[model samples]
Each structure stands twice: as C-alpha cells, then as structure tokens.
Target: MNRENAPSTLAADYARAVDDRQFSAMETLMWPEFTQQGPGFSAESRTVFIANLAVLRSFDSTFHLLGQVAGEWQGDQYRGETYCVASHFFQRDGRSLCMDMGIRYQDVIEVRGGEARYLSRDLNVVWQDEREITAPILG
Candidate 1:
C-alpha cells in the first residue's frame, strides 16, 4: 500500500475490528502505547482499551460506517480525522432500539516500513439519534 493510503486503511480496519468485536486484531493494528479517548471513556494503553471494549457486548450488534477520511504525514506520524456514523442496536425495556452516533475520530498513526499502526485515537461525537427499530435486524 502507498504511504498516503495507510491512514485511511488503518481507520477503516480499526472500525471493522470494533464492529466485529475482534480484540485480537487490535494488537496488530495499534501500538502498545495506544490510547483512546472518547465521550465518557478513556484508555491509556491498548490493553486497557481492549478490556474496556467489553461494554460493547451489552449491545446486540453494532455497525460503524466510515465517511470522510483525510490526513497527512507529519514527520514519522500521520494525523487525521475520520468521520463515521456508528449504529448500536439492542433491546431495552422489551423494545428494540437503535442508537446512531455521528462521530469524528481524531487519529495519530505511526508509519513504519510503509505500514501503519494507531498511536492514539480521540473520538468526538458530533450528534446522536436514538429511536425504536420497528424492522427486524436479521430478517
């Protein structure tokens, strides 16, 4: 992959890792010092970040759709922002609801030998919409 495309690919890959609940994949995607800061959440290390992801299990499913991904290389690190719409579906109070959040991920990635790994990611939620889901998720 070209150096310029690494940031975009890294962002999408990380989103897939979260949606798939594949914590193991994160080890390869992030540096050991990886930190994640978001609304009501903070993790200082990759281990802590992965451990905290267990909270996602409360939801039946989640889908993170990436929109705009733009960044540039700054010395050895790449800094960028990724816009996303993340939907979390779950049953609450005998009713199914979907929470969709517009999030912007401010990311710093370290590129080595033309490969990229996340150094840090700060999540900024631009907006959110929660509504009941009348349609079936799987059917």
Candidate 2:
C-alpha cells in the first residue's frame, strides 16, 4: 500500500493482534522502543507492552471495531488518531456481560526499512458502558 494508508492499516492490524491474542505479531508492528499509555496503564518498550497484554487473557473474548483513522506526515514520523469501540466479554454468575469502551488512540509511527510500525500510542477512553448480554453469542 501507499505511505498515506500505512498508518490506518497499522492501527487496524494492532486491534486484530490484540483481539486474536497473537502477541507475537506485535514484534513486526511495533518498534523495539514502542511505548503504550492507557487509562491507569502504561508500558515502556514493545516487550513490556506485549507482556502487559496478558491481562486480556482474563476475558472470554474481545472485539475491537476500528472507526475513523487519519494521519499526516510529521517530519520523520507520522502522527495519527484512531477511533475504536472495544468490547470485552466475560461470564459472571452464569450470565454473560460485556463492557464496551469508546477509545481514541493517539499514535506515532516511524518507518524503518520501508516498513511502518508504531513508536508510541496513547489510548484515551471517551466513554464506557457495561451491560448483560441478552442474546446468545454465536461463533
């Protein structure tokens, strides 16, 4: 793809990597110095970030729906914003519950060896909701 579309694709790929529990993919998507900041959470280095992802294993499933994504070249890096609705599913007392978080990711990326990867990402949670699931979850 073109350079202009690389950031958006990278954002979506990150969501998939997280949701699918493919932590190894992060090595290719993030720089070694990658850092992540989120609500009450912060990690330095891609290795630390990948290790921190173990928390996601506590959930039964997760789905991150990527929304608007836009970026612009800034000197030697690209700055972008990615909107996402992240849903976390789990069972509590034999009832299914879901927690949905409206997240905005402020990202910074730099291309290395003609491949773009994240240098840093800050996750902002604009809103959140939690409710019981009434419909059956289908695969």
Candidate 3:
C-alpha cells in the first residue's frame, strides 16, 4: 500500500482482527514495543495487550469500525484516528446483558521495511450503554 493509505489499511485490518478474535494475526501488526493507553487501561507490550483482548473475548463481543476520522504521514510515521462501535453480550445468573460503546482510537504507526506496525494507541470511549435483556428469576 502507498504511504497515504497505509495507516487506514492497518487500522482496518486491526479492527477486523479484533472483531474476529484473531489475536495471533493481531500480533503481526504490532511493533515489539507496542503499547496501548485507554480511558482506564494500559498495556505496555503486545503480550499484555493480547491478554487483555482475551478478557474482552470472554464476554462474546463484536466490534465494528465506523470509519477513519483522520490520518497523516510524518516522515516514516503515521498518525490516525478511527471511530468504532462495540457490543458485549453475556449471561449472568440466567439473565442476558449487553454493554455497547462508541469508541475512538488515536494511533501512531511506523513503517519499517515496507511493513506498517502499530507503535502506540490511545483508546477513548465516547459513549456507552448497559442493559439487561432478560429479567432476573426469583425463587
């Protein structure tokens, strides 16, 4: 991909990997020193990041990339932002629940040897909703 399109492409691929729960593939897209900082979370390495993803997967979730908000190339580095929507579905005590959120990712990516790797990302939650889909049973 050309320099102008690389960031968006990488972001899209990463979003797809998350949605598919393909942690292995996600590993290839990150730098060895990859880090992510979010509203109330931080991961300083790919291993920890992937492990955090595993926790999210436990809820049975789906992520959708709404769009790439903006992007720019600076030297060998690219900065971009993307909007996303996610839904987490789970059952507790036989009651179904869901948590949905609107999020934005501010990413810094670097191109090395013609491959793009995510150097860092800051995730911000724009909105959220939590609801119970089934009433709790009472004995």
Candidate 4:
C-alpha cells in the first residue's frame, strides 16, 4: 500500500480493535521499545496501556469516536490522530449518573519487517462529564 494508505488502514484496524476491546491486536502495532507521548502520555507503560482496556471493557456504556484520521503517515512511519468517548452509568443520589470522557489520540507508527508497529501514542483530554468525574487535565 502507499504510505498514506498505510496509516489510514492502520487507523481503521486500530479503531475497531479499540472499540471491540481487542487489546491483543495492539501487540501487532506496538514495538517492544515503543515510547509514546506527545502532550500527555496516555498510559504509563505498555502494560498500563493494556490494563486500561480492561477498564474500558467493564464500562456499561461507551461511545468511541467516528473513527476518523486527523494525521498522516510519512516514509517508513505512520502518524495520525484519533478520538474516543466512553461512558459508565450507576445509581447515585437516587438517580443514574454517568461518567463520560473523551480521548484525543496522537500516534506514531513504525513499519518493521513488513509490519506496522506503534512507536508512540499521546492521548489528551478533550471533554468530560460532570457527575462524579475524575479531575480533568486543564493544561
């Protein structure tokens, strides 16, 4: 595939893997020494990254993105942006309250031995709900 097509293709596959909670597919894109950060390191480490998928899977409701690409791939690497929104509901204050959050993903992909691997991914906060929400990063 062409350089541009490569990243878009990767993005599509990744979005699906994420929405489906298929964390194993991440191994296909993540390099052993993957170092991901841009404005904020989304996950502390690869292990932490994988662990979050479990949290995601446990959520009662989640709304993750239009699955669009906001960046491009260059040379032997792919770089792009992605988005995801997830929500959870529970009984509180005699009513159901939802916790919602949005993740803006800025990523880098490196192709090795004919496979595209993740070099880095930075996820920034875009939005949050107000019902017992966690502290938001205001930087």
Candidate 5:
C-alpha cells in the first residue's frame, strides 16, 4: 500500500480492535511513544492504553449502541477524529447500570509499513460525568 493510504489502514485496524475487544491486538496499534492527553484523560504510552482493559472488562463487557464511522477526515499529517458510541454497563454496588454517550475519539496516528498506528488518542466523552450522585433509578 502506498504511504498515503497507510493512515486509513491504521484507522480500520483500530476499528476492528475496538469491535472485537482484542486488547492485545489493540496494543500493537499504537506507537510506543504515544502520549495521550485531554480534558479528562492523560494516558501516555501504549501500555497504559492496553493494560486498562483488564480492569474495564471486570466491570463492563458489552459494547452497546455502536454505530457507523460517524465522521472521518484527515489533515496534513495522519491525524483525524472518529465519533463512535458504545453503551457500556458500569458496575456499582454489585449492580449493572448502562451508560450511553456520543464519544468523539480524537486520535493522533501514523502509518508505517502499510499499517496505521495510533500515536495518541483522547476518548472525548462528549456526555456524562462520573456517576457520583447520578444513581440509577430502579425499583
């Protein structure tokens, strides 16, 4: 694949990794020097991104309310944003509560050797804050 097309490949792989929940595979999709930072996230390096899956899985296992690419575009470099939604259940007090949000997955990525890889990403949770006083209303 040409160098220009590499970015798309990387983006596609990332989508696959998320869909399959292949934590290990997802690890290979990012560069070692990746530094992720944003308003609410401060993840640096690939290990930090992939390692958190275990803990997340212990609490939430299903990705619900998923949709299409939503939006896609590239700039001078291999940088773009993809908006996606995943309704996941959060475990609280031995109960499962579902939360849905329209997330803007801002990613700084690169393509090398025909494979696209992530350098940094900020999962901009466009909605919802910590479930502090936000208790789920149930009977």
Candidate 6:
C-alpha cells in the first residue's frame, strides 16, 4: 500500500473486521495501547475495546459502511472519519426486534514501520430506532 493511503486502507480493513466479527484480525490492526471514546463509553486499552466488541457480537448485529471521508495527514499521524449503519436483530417474547443506528467514527491513526495502527477513535451516534419486525430465518 502507498504510504499516503495506508490510513484509509486500515480504516476500511477495520470496518470489515468489525462487520465480520473477526476479532483476531482486528487485534492485529490495533496498537496495544489503543483507546476509544464514544457517546457513553470509553476504552482505555485495546483489551477493553476488544472485549466490548465480543459483547456486541453476541447481539447478532450487522454493520454497514455508509461512507468514509478521506484521511488527512497531521504531522506524523492521519485523521479520518467513517459513517456507518448498524442493525441488531433479536427475538423477545416470540417477537422479533430490530434496532438500527447511524454512527460516525473519528479516528487518529499512526503509521510505524509501514503498518498503520489505530491510536485513538471517537464514536458518535447520530440517530437510532428500534422496531418490531418479522423474524428473519437464521442460518
């Protein structure tokens, strides 16, 4: 990957990993001291972030990328933003429920030895909704 494009590539890879629930791959993409701050939550370390992701995976959610803004280099780091749409599916009282949310992630990434790593990420939830829906077949 071109040095200038590494951050964008990393962001796309990270989003794919999250959508696929690929924890191990995600681990490789983060710095050991990674931190994340969001609307109502903060992770002080990569461990906590990954653990939180595990919980989210249990909810049977699918994440979709709405768009990604180009990254800008700031000194030795890059900053970027990604917009996402996520839907969580669950069954309660023999009825299906789906919760959808529009989220934005602001990321600060660092490149070391030609590999891009996530240093910090800020998450914002722009909108959300929950509704009852016909249950979709689960494979």
- TM-scores, in order shown? 0.93, 0.94, 0.85, 0.66, 0.65, 0.85
TM for candidate 2 is: 0.94
Better of 1 and 2 by lDDT: 2
**Cα lDDT of model 5 by residue, 1-139, tens digit:** 4555555555666666655678788767787877767555566777776776564565444453433333233543466666666555667876557666677767676655655577777777787533423435679
* Model 2 C-alpha lDDT per residue in residues 39-129, reported as the tens digit of each score: 9999999999999999999998899999998878976699989999999998899989999999999999998778888999999999999
Model 2 lDDT, residue 22, Cα = 97
Q: What's the true lDDT of residue 75 in model 1?
A: 85
Per-residue lDDT of candidate 6, residues 25-101 (tens digit): 86788898999998778899889998888777666566666576666888668888877777777777788788888
Please list the residue runs of candidate 5 whose C-alpha ends up more than 4 Å from where it truly belongs after superposition: 1-20, 38-40, 64-76, 90-96, 129-139
Best by lDDT: 2
Query: How many Å off is the CA of 37 in candidate 5?
Result: 2.9
Worst 10 residues of 2 by lDDT: 1-10
Looking at candidate 1, the ten consecutive residues that score lowest on lDDT are 130-139
Give the lowest summed-lDDT range of ten residues in model 4.
Answer: 58-67
Clashing pairs in 3: none
Per residue, candidate 3 scores C-alpha lDDT tens digits across 1-139 of: 6777777777788878888888888788899889999877899998888888877767756656566568888989988888877777777887788888888988899999988888997889999998887644659
Collision count of model 2: 0
